[model samples]
Target: MAKATRWRNFTRSEAFSGYVLVSPTAIYAVLLLAAPLATIVAFSFFKDGYLTVIREFTLQNYVDTWSDPVFRAILLRSLFVSGMVTLTTVLIAFPIAYYISFNVSRSMKSRWLFLITIPFWTSYLIRVFLWKVILGYNGVINSTLDIVGLIDQPLNMLNNVQAIVVTLAHAYAPFAILPIFVALEKIDRALLEAGQDLGESRLMTFWRVTLPLAMPGVVAAVLIVFIPTIGDYVTPQLIGGGKVPMVANLIQARMLDLDNKPMGSAIAVSAMAIVTLVSLLFLFLNRRFLRVQK
Candidate 1:
């Protein structure tokens, strides 16, 4: 009885110490994330426009935002762009991840990994702007095609959906690759050997063993790529040439240009809700995938 009491006391002391050690991080999170979220939620209910606060509750903002055609179009366009970007980044990154984890030698793998991530060392804005120059009317792409007699005139490549997708893909590809690579790296080599020993083909082993183990990374990459692309304002504005209006742009214009703070807040809230839903769905899928593998 004495020993049991001593162990219980020791466990309680350890738990208290652990909480004390983590208290700093908890306080930071409350300040940075929780506090701001609470502010946004509170602001959503207030009757405020620009510099004036009416201190009353109203649903007119949501009503007007939902009724606006332009806002709806921007929301839809944001979804489409984020979806395409996620799909393209994942599909392209998977093969590179597969090769790195399963095929390459150790020395070559390090070199190739360095090469893949080296693009990120450059300025992000400069990289996106380079695409702008390349796709412009007098850009290198058009000049090269003309020189090769493949085209008589420059193609209309700039300020379009294609430009936005290409730019975003380049920017987000590393995120997809890194997660999948981490998942692939965690897989045991012995599992593959055992599968082969049981007469499973390479493709069969990959489908059953490799892919299942790499699912956590896949889900992580999807969330990372999709979440940011959905809210990206700069890429669409710069490359989309004012033709495509994402949800972020619409919200910004509403708040800054039109002085419609209420509608802007509504749009912001709507976008946040969509993002929250997608993130939850991704988590569910990831949990399901993990369970199936088990």
Candidate 2:
């Protein structure tokens, strides 16, 4: 039959093979990513009983989350901290990325990149703890200052927002750098030569030509640093000394400590929503830059 033959032909096709190749990843995504998200979304709408999540649908969880002053302040603080980290990371990363892309020889570039990743050789937790040691009351800076007779008292460096920002900015610096470096590397050097030939100064040429071509990488770096830093629990907990808890810490407290799954789910959902919107905005900017690059 014609229909039977058509079905048989399709099964033998490359398109079918492509689908077969992709099916495992697709299945994994659905099971792990989509299912967890759906479960959280369902839990966020349910009511919280003493130690149990009531199946009854309610919007009160969201209402309570949004209405709480503490939650609002913490959420705003998370945003501010992430924005500051993103700004700081990108500003610092650009020069390093630029130096690697423009100044370093191709043979030496790999060595430079390897050195940049040297921090990742240690466990992330160990790195954070090391920061705590350096920033604590009697830590490196204060001890050195005291030894040098610079100060009588050890400075209170930890347990503050500034400390959180510093720790996070350092941890996520490489994430920002790699993408911008990739972007800078993609730019054609001949374009720079052409700009100079057209009577443009190096600074002006960079501002007009190099920077625009590199915007996609910078945008990628922003999303990379911004998203994870906003939801970060470890740096805020370990470095900020529990005093400057972010949304992740609050969600952990609500979910585990309080045994209020529904409330925790609501807070988690709200945080996800905020992150989603910000991510989309940057993704839009990335697309615009891509089109311009084209």
Best by TM-score: 2
For model 1, the stretches where C-alpha displacement exceeds 4 angstroms are: 1-12, 286-294
TM-score of 2: 0.94
lDDT of 2 by residue, 1-294 (tens): 999999999999999999999999999999999999999999999999998889999999999999999899999999999999999999999999999999999999999999999999998899899999999998999999999999999999999988888888889899999999999999999999999999999998988799989998998899999999999999999998798999999999999999999999999999989998988987887788767655
Show model 2 residue runs off by greater than 4 Å.
1-3, 283-294
Residue 202's C-alpha lDDT in candidate 2?
A: 99
Candidate 1 TM-score, C-alpha based:
0.88
| lDDT tens per residue, model 1, 105-212 | 987988888989998899888888888898989899999999999998899998778789999999999989988999999999999999999999999988889888
The collision pairs in model 1 are none
Q: How does residue 252 of candidate 2 score in lDDT?
A: 98
In model 1, which range of ten residues has the least summed lDDT? Answer: 46-55
Looking at model 2, which ten-residue stretch has the lowest summed lDDT? 285-294
